[model samples]
Target: MATEFEMKEIKSGDPEAARHSSMAAPQKSVTVKFENLNYSVSIKAKKTVTEKVILNNVSGMFKPGKFTAIMGNSGSGKTSLLNAGAVKGGKISGDLIINGEKMDTKFMKKMSAFVMQDDVILGTMTVREAITMSALLRLPPEIPKSEKLDRVDEIISMLRLDKAQNTVIGSTRVKGVSGGERKRTGNLIIFKIPAMAMEMVTNPSIILLDEPTSGLDSFTAYSVCTTLSDLAEQGRTVVATIHQPSSDIFLIFDDLLLLSEGRVAYYGPSSAVIDYFTKIDYPFPDYVNPADFIFMHILNNSEEAKQADKKKDALNKVLLEWDNSENKKVMLNTPATQKGLPADVMKVNASFYEQFRFLLTRAGKNVWRNALMVRARLGQAVFLGILLGLVYRDVSSRPLKSQTQALGIFLASVFEDVQVALFLAPMLIMPMMVFSGFLINNNNIPVYFNWIKYLSPIKYGFTAAAKNEFQGLVMTDQFGSLTGEKVLDDLAFTDELPVDQNLYVLLSMFIILIGMAYMALWRATKKVV
Candidate 1:
């Protein structure tokens, strides 16, 4: 039951070409295929909350290389469907297939690239760096660095991002690229944007993009459509949930799979959508786009648009019949037979590195590129050391010096506090670094107080200062003699020992503080992601 567009586009110009395309289809297939795939998410009811049914037994074949749009009103299961297909922990019951092989729920994550509605780009990377880092992490090792750069270059070229190629991607406050540019970069890193497609090896055969043009202008949205259409032409399955696209973008779709209250109301060629509605007596208005018309119709119906209701019975019956009919199953299966494979089918060894050189190169590149950042940070450490050393320069064998040095050592311990804070900086500032060193990852900030977190840098820079300030000091006071505890009670304890025991202890504290901070950072990012 592949839609006509999917079938026609693949079978269009040359039969031999179509055959080759089919051979390239992803291996594996899905079962009972979303048979009764329904879901609901609970929300707290007291805080102006709304209850929603995200999806309802909506099923369809996701053929390789076919561009499909999952059309629906806001809160419909479009995003839910994509999430279910990609991420897990949903209330799922249907089977997803690939080449007749049942898609193991546990393995679905490895098989899909899900670009969420909100752009998930880290704010500090340049376009090429983001894409390159992603390539290093995910691309098959068969693609070399030279080829990877070429691939990045091609994607940058394809996106018409030549002007902003070297621009940093971040918010306006941080000063860098524009929103569209950053969105594209984020997508590129995750393989939703065109720039990363050329060298993508670990990319899922089926791409699920949620609102690929959610925040763009008409022209930009159109550009996104064109890019996706080009991907489809190249024989990759593209599924996107979009809203309010202009007519120009509407036409680029091969199929429009419309949803209403979690049900498939229309799943066919974009050209035939209006006719399908007209045939069902819910004709589109004279000037209304069919996409808009359908959304209006569903919205007017509300949550009460039950299949068995009689007032709007004609529309509901027709759509429901279509869903239950054997023809729909045929539509679901057509892609398989056309490609000579089943759904949920997987092929192509996603394992990119089976060799040592490949892994070492990735590791080496990571270390090399980070060399400057690391050194600059370490230089800050040395500067802190000078400052602290100067601050505690007067520690001596006298009682006054012992008291002063003891206080200095305590202030130096603040460096340990600062070191702890510095390591935590990466946890908050670059969590994804723990993953692939690609971009800085910031967790969600509360709407009211996020600004405070944005300006704080005390955690990262203070520790280095403390460690450099307090090592190798002999401060003696009469209090040590008076107390008989040698705790700086008297100035009696002068030391040749400052360079040995005291220095070693101070150095140990420095190393210990740094080690603790680094370990904390590693664990935080690992756990957070």
Candidate 2:
């Protein structure tokens, strides 16, 4: 019986594999490289703000299948380099080669995934639900539903996140998924690279994380880096921008690309970086981390260093030359760095309809499972209705004096009820639902939607309440008594069933309120949170 790894090897072999068992199989490697990369953001001020360069003449290459860390001082171009790959906005100039092909920004976006420093996961989605929607919407336009599920399961297994797969990303109100799970969820969605799941994750070509360990505990950070190191060994290109990493975490990096004020101060294997720094006249003191030492050197900016234009120019030139060298390009060699998913994994006929169904399915499951704080919302709406009903149950016998007074009370009560309905409906429910839907779908609504008023539960509730109270009330009697008997005809008691109508109206309003609440929430959360 063949082992799983052996099976994978046999199945992954090319068509010629069956014909020549003794033939030497050609080795695969990542041909990813970069040249003359530059990114600069504009500082627009009311009165021409001074220009500050973020990334200056930055050029570097990332070897495939290596755990590479881009480190620098606060303003160092570490993140800017990652951003220059895609989505990050700025004037950019450079050649990025992936798989021996010059990478355009658009193509790079498809080939790479960029993770930001902040957590962008929505609150209403469960861990599994979030990853599933991502797989549906992001996977190349050709993969099938069955394959997408398989891929999601693969990612869950790869990240060791199966434990929290079903947990909602709850907020402060309730305990929810852990930060690591949330981060992994974001990664699975943003980066649609399928081969990443089966491969060990050290240096990943498909995944580029910005400050992966920032703000995490030491143990967690080290664990993340350890997993990343494993990925690198599997021949994936994993590039990350890290700041002030712990010593234990620091040990995990295979390579370090250190920058100071947009200049490459060090670019080599992590073990050699400290000795290289010492040779360059910037020795690390005892107990001082090499990462921190490099950062401090760039941020020092002493009067002598600042004033010596010649030294600065020379440093800049060395940095530029080192960055443009050919050895850096050779470092990216990894077996699976350029090996994409098999044709079976990458589909061409994946349609918007199918993707939509997956999104819809994931969203529906989340709603049905009540995994999205829905119970709390449903409970809140019911509680609000009961509370408001009990608070303002009977306003039928209130005085109505002048026409102005009647208008005031009527407007106050109806509008107040409308406001309450609108407030609770959109407020309690909108953020989570809006968060859920818009989190995946890019659909937009007009700013001034007249139809929205028709859809408002507050409008329905307010109107229903008004109809019950004043559908047949004597407008004149409600005010002061009129001087003529003709007014009495209008005020005279009629055969109308006011009490029953009030009861029906109240019930209708209550039902409509419930329906509207559900509808708004339903539309909002009908996607990954």
User: Which candidate number would show the highest TM-score if scored against the true structure?
Assistant: 1
Using alpha carbons, what is the TM-score of model 2? Answer: 0.59
Candidate 1's C-alpha runs over 4 A off are 1-33, 39-53, 105-111, 122-124, 188-204, 301-329, 332-335, 338-393, 419-485, 488-529
Q: Candidate 1 residues 1-529, lDDT tens each?
A: 2111222332222223212211223433222134456666556577776555677777776655567888876666787787666544345656666545565644555455566555545445566766766665555555676765666666666666779877766653346788777666555323233322322334345567878787887766776667666656665677888877766677678877877667787776777776655655666666565666666664345535454355355557766767766657766755453322334324333254543444566556544445455688799889988987886675545645544654555455445455445646655533222221011112333345435432332212222222233334344465552221333212212221332444454566567767987798877644322
Candidate lDDT scores, in order, read 0.55, 0.55
* Candidate 2 lDDT over residue span 338-369, tens digit each: 54321232234347697777767766755655
Model 2 poorest 10 in a row by lDDT: 1-10
